[model samples]
Target: MRRFFAIGLLAIHLFNIAGYSLVFQYFIYQTDTNLITKLDLNQYRESELIQFKIPISVPYIADRPDYERVDGQVEIKGVLYTYVKRKIERDTIYLQCLPNRVTQRLSKARNAYTKHVNDLPQSKKNQTGSTIKKSGIFSEYDFKTLDYQFAAPLATASTYISYLSPSPVPGALEVPGKPPENRG
Candidate 1:
């Protein structure tokens, strides 16, 4: 009788552990973030980069998001220069594609980088200004990944890996000439 009781308890514990593991996996997700900053950017009054990580995390049981968005504002000398967001819809989103503006901007940066590198030796150019935003999906036979980037000249950047279930925040978009929020 005692042997049977021990085996029953062991079976129950195994089932409980497996149940907890599956529940944990259901709630977990990944947000792969990367930010690139320039080392000497502060020396240039006309240039600055500011970033924010907005929270969109929620429990899967409560709500699941089909669209994920990141919104942030860039301020230079306490003045808002631009507001940017990366909003992707799952059903309509192609696995790996750059947004129109991001593609154009990165292409422009590459062109500028090539020009500046060539011009520096021939002329007296001491500095080259470059910036880019690029994001896309990377796919292989085994897996697909979401990735993004921010770039500036003269330094390598930092990347952050997070597991945050996401949702979009309404009214997060800002346009040029619109009244700015008080960031003070």
Candidate 2:
């Protein structure tokens, strides 16, 4: 008798569980489903969009440095270089010339072009002008130059963002002295 009673109770529990499962499934099947619709692209217009502008003068980093161009005349080390009309005189005699040696005169493009003048007293960076002073069989010339350095400004990048977050629940953990993104 005890065995039969225990079996009857187990059957009742199984029946209840099966009936509850069927009811849950029926409720789930009877619920309404969300409808799928195609999006209407025409609703959004190009003019309604927000415009963000970045006004940085330098677009990208420069691989080669830039130098400040000194206009007019640059002066250094007690010498000044200025653009001026320069005249040079050339009158020479090769005392001991080799049979295979040759001499090239200055180009007439910048030449004084006068019968009495030969050396054009021009201030060029790397030019070694004719003898400033000649003594007997030796001569000495002068060169003008200035040491310049290249420089460029370093690029700087700064970024900022505005974020909006819904207000936190009435009672939530928050950082000290800091408010949520959207306060207004």
Candidate 3:
């Protein structure tokens, strides 16, 4: 009877440790890293829907949106990530993300174009008596029309979720109330 009781206690302790480890890993991945989940397109088919739990810090957790296709972006560590909010269950947010490279490239190009356009007038001022240049061939409205015509036929972009490891610094759990803890 004594040996059986000792074995039962050990089993209970081991199960407790296993449960705590699972919860700790889940918390670390959700809050400390940019990873949506451990699962990715490589592990499943492109058409299959992958659901993951999100931290409560995410917006619209209480007031769920009526539309299924809500788009949102979050900036983590100065990098912007674009994702579509497909469904929401309490704090869990199910969504698909756009590749970081594509979004980053588009953002950079937009900034460069804006800078170039802003400087165009200054450069024109320096050139005296130069022949007047014609306006761009396509007007703003023309581009909108073109987009409407081609938007549906274009293929939807597929993306693979990328992961970023947590920083080496100690988190709040490791050092409570410490000034050196990284809040970002």
Q: Which candidate's lDDT is highest?
A: 3
- Candidate that beats the other on TM-score, 2 or 3, i.e. the better one: 3
The sequence of per-residue lDDT tens digits that candidate 3 reaches over residues 97-116 is: 44344445555554444445
> Order of candidates by lDDT, top first?
3, 1, 2
Q: Over 4 Å off in model 2, which ranges?
A: 1-11, 33-184
**Clash pairs for candidate 2:** 88-118, 88-119, 88-120, 89-118, 89-119, 90-118
lDDT of 3: 0.50
Task: Report the lDDT of model 2 for residue 86.
Answer: 18
Backbone clashes in each candidate structure, one number apiece? 0, 6, 0
Writing each residue's lDDT as its tens digit, candidate 1 over 68-119 gives 3333334344343233223333322212111223323444444454445334
For TM-score, the strongest prediction is 3
- Candidates by TM-score, descending order: 3, 1, 2
What digit string (tens of lDDT, one per residue) describes model 2 on residues 1-184? 9999999999888755454444444443332111001002222233432222223344443422222221122233433322111111232111111111010112121122321133434434234644232122223344569999987866876787756667556446677885669858
